[model samples]
Target: MENKDKTDWRFKVANREALIGCGLALLNFVWWFGFAYGMGSRPVEEYSYILGMPDWFFYSCVVGFLLITALVIFVVKVFFKEVPFEEEEELR
Candidate 1:
């Protein structure tokens, strides 16, 4: 008689995690690319003004946007989600 241990669900869980990571990374890449292009194309003279500050100040917002975007992706990967697998435990 042979005793077999079954643990085949991990593969699917890991694959799901990889897929989520890839999708999020791609989204971040697209967002940063768009921001860089938009900023690079904007004329210095046309910078948006806020409280009399030059429009380039708006680019600072882009930096914040990038940070927040990264944080959101990180949070999504870390918390708010779990791969569907046959196992009852979450992957580390």
Candidate 2:
């Protein structure tokens, strides 16, 4: 009797995908935080605008959302693999 769970390849794929997801999430957060705090620390009177939006808000919220969305789509198409959920029977 061998353990099938330990030998499952899907687990490996799932874990790799999970780590990639976490990494992307962290990257998005860092980007948002850096832009929001770094550019927004100045006084409101000194704030700059881009396309009718504040610089910090434009870059941190709008741009970051679009960038992360594209990155997630790329990652899913490139790095993520499709694994079947049904249990496969062992061959005798």
How big is the positional error of residue 17 in model 1, measured in Å on the Cα after superposition?
Answer: 1.1
Q: What's every prediction's RMSD, in angstroms?
A: 7.5, 1.8
lDDT of 2 by residue, 1-92 (tens): 76976588998999999999999999999999999999999999999999999999999999999999999999999999999999999887
**Residue 24 C-alpha lDDT in model 2:** 99
Off by over 4 Å in 1: 1-7, 49-92
The worst-scoring run of ten residues by lDDT in candidate 2 lies at 1-10
The clash count for each model shown is 2, 0
For candidate 2, give the lDDT: 0.96
For residue 43, give model 1's deviation from the true position in Å: 1.9
Model 2 TM-score relative to the real fold: 0.92
C-alpha lDDT score of every prediction, in listed order: 0.62, 0.96
TM-scores of all predicted structures? 0.49, 0.92
